[model samples]
Target: MMRRFLAILLAAAVLLPSCLRHRPGDSGEATQQKDTVLPLGFLTDAYQVDSSRVRDGETFSGLMNRLGMGARDAYTLVQRCDSIFDVRRMRAGNDVEAYYSADSSGRRLEYVVYHNDRIRSTVFQCRDSICGWVYSRPVQKVRKIADVTIHNSLWNDMIDAGASPLLIVDLADVYAWTVNFFGLQEGDRFRVVYNQTESDGEVIRIDGIDFALYNSGSFSASAIRFDQGDGGNKYWNEKGESMRKAFLKAPLQFTRISSRFTYHRKHPITGKVRPHTAVDYAAPTGTPVHSIGDGTVTLCGWDGSGGGNRIRIRHMNGYETCYMHLSKYASGIRQGSRVAQGQVIGYVGSTGHSTGPHLDFRVWKDGTPIDPLKMISPPSEPLRSENLDSLGKLYQAYLDTLSAR
Candidate 1:
């Protein structure tokens, strides 16, 4: 069971440019075209641009010194970059651009641009004054389609389909409330239509998922993105029901269930038959453990009953949950502390029990220990009647777009 769950956890890729543009700007490339804006808002025709990567163990001050700037000017430039862009963040191997004056035998450097990442950069002026400011490339949203069949696991299959791992994470988040990802079987398949934020023809991040369908031979679940004047977007099914539930399906994102709840079970360490009510999730140590539902921490301390570090939370409707063998509690989490659903409350660890790193999770209903896998959670509010037609139209439009492929 744990191996299959691990296989499921270890699981995109077509590029379809969307019609939406995030901001007004062209690709920051040095071009001969008139008025062409290079990086840092400098016109390519106005200056000679030299691009290079930051050498290993090179500092901003050292770069300036190598560029012929005096020590005092480099020091002042470093000081001005404090609040704008910390010089310490100028990581090695990152791209850097130096702008030189057009008509100069001196070959003097006027502006230096350091790429913080692919999308963000910092421009440092070094001609006469020492100042710096941050700049971000204009991002554009591109709709992408990923249709994959589960051969081994979602992770490996999606990767084999040329999809980004980031997209897999997003898809997992979209179905966090409903899908039993740990129970994914062979031949299962899914299709998703999502948006990717792109800059300079490269994906910056996943904007969001618009539509998704998971087919497991016997059951099919569809998620459609819709908004009904809630000032935020949400996912719903074809019947106008919300996809979000009161609690998440699991406490951790990607891990295998090492143990199941059973009355007749043998303890691994003790080698004795006993009732094991908790579901054991086996993951690496320090993996974040999240609260399945919103609640207040009732008990956050060590357990002397061989459970090790434990946290107990009381929820609504006479429901309570316990997380055992935590390596440590999340910051600000203690007795009486309020926690939101899906919030990280602790991390997976092997603190007290005789086993490797894992989270021992248990749930109770009216003071009776229950199986968490069998627990059913209430769904969020459905779409209002007035908004059903709008959702239908939007969902159909997405379907048409997806079906075109």
Candidate 2:
């Protein structure tokens, strides 16, 4: 299961670009023509542009000197831009663009732009005195739809169908409460309608997913994004039920069960027949382990005998969960810490009484050990009736699209 999950993730990353090629309205034609001219920040057509990535050990002063600015001028420019845009804080591998005056003999610097991220940038302008200001780049959001069939796994199948790898994560999150990803079988499929954000013709991120439909063997599920007029948006089902459950289906993303809770089983290390009270999830060392539900950390330390670095979370209604064999705890994860569902609390490790790196996950109900796999958590409140009609129409429209495909 671990290998299959990883394969799905890896395939998504490898196949996203190809899958996107089939998206509607994504023609290969360039949006900007060769004759079309554009300004570089505050600089006009009279400047020559040079773009490069910040190199290791490169300093602002050194960059300015190489760009034909005198040492005194570089120092003065750095001083003026210190508060607005600290040149010292420039990071390696980020894009930097320098605009120089068109004159061949006296090629003076006009402006310098540093791209902080997809939407934010900092510009340093030179005139009588140098000054800097932060600005935003315009982003475009495009709506797209896809119908994907699961062959091996959802991640791999989506990639094969030319959808974004990030979309896989988002879709999984939407159905986290309703679906058991580990239980997904062959022939399962899903359809999704989502928006993709782009800047300068490059995909920046997935803006949001509007709707989704998942069909697993005999079971089918749907999720629709709706606004409740309370300044928050949530995913709800076709029947106006909230998709969020009290507890997540699993503690970690993309994992498989290595061992199950059983009685009279032979131990791997000791070779002694005993009752195993927990389920073990085999994963790579350092894989993030998340809290199964919202709770308070009651115990956050080592268990000397084979438990290794462990954490016990106490939940509402006499429920408790334990995560063992963690290599290290997440920051702010200590005794008495409050953790939300899906929050990373530790990482997979083989610290004590373990043959390999895996998570020994356990749960207790009313102080009695139970099968974590069989624990069924209740869903959150259903959508209010006042907004049901509008959401129902939206959900039907998405469902129609899925059926058409």
How well does each candidate superpose onto the true structure, as a TM-score?
0.74, 0.73
Which candidate tops lDDT?
A: 1
Which segments of candidate 2 are over 4 A away from where they belong? 1-74, 80-113, 119-138, 231-233, 260-266, 271-275
**Regions more than 4 Å wrong, model 1:** 1-73, 79-114, 123-139
TM-score (C-alpha) between model 1 and the true structure: 0.74
Predicted candidate 1 versus true structure: per-residue lDDT over 1-405, tens digit per residue = 776443333210111111111112254422333233234444434667888888999988898887667889998877766777777877999988887774436677777778888777777777654676666666678888988889998899988876666787888888888788877888888889988988757778988888998999889888998877677538898889888888888999889989999998989988999999989999999999999999999999999988888999999999999999999999999999999999999998899974799999999999999999888888888888998998888878877876898
lDDT of 2 at 306: 80
Q: What is the C-alpha RMSD of each candidate to the true structure, in Å?
A: 11.0, 11.4
Model 2 lDDT per residue over 99-203, tens place: 777554776677777787767777766545466666654567888887888788777888798887778778879988888777677888888899998766677
lDDT of each: 0.81, 0.79
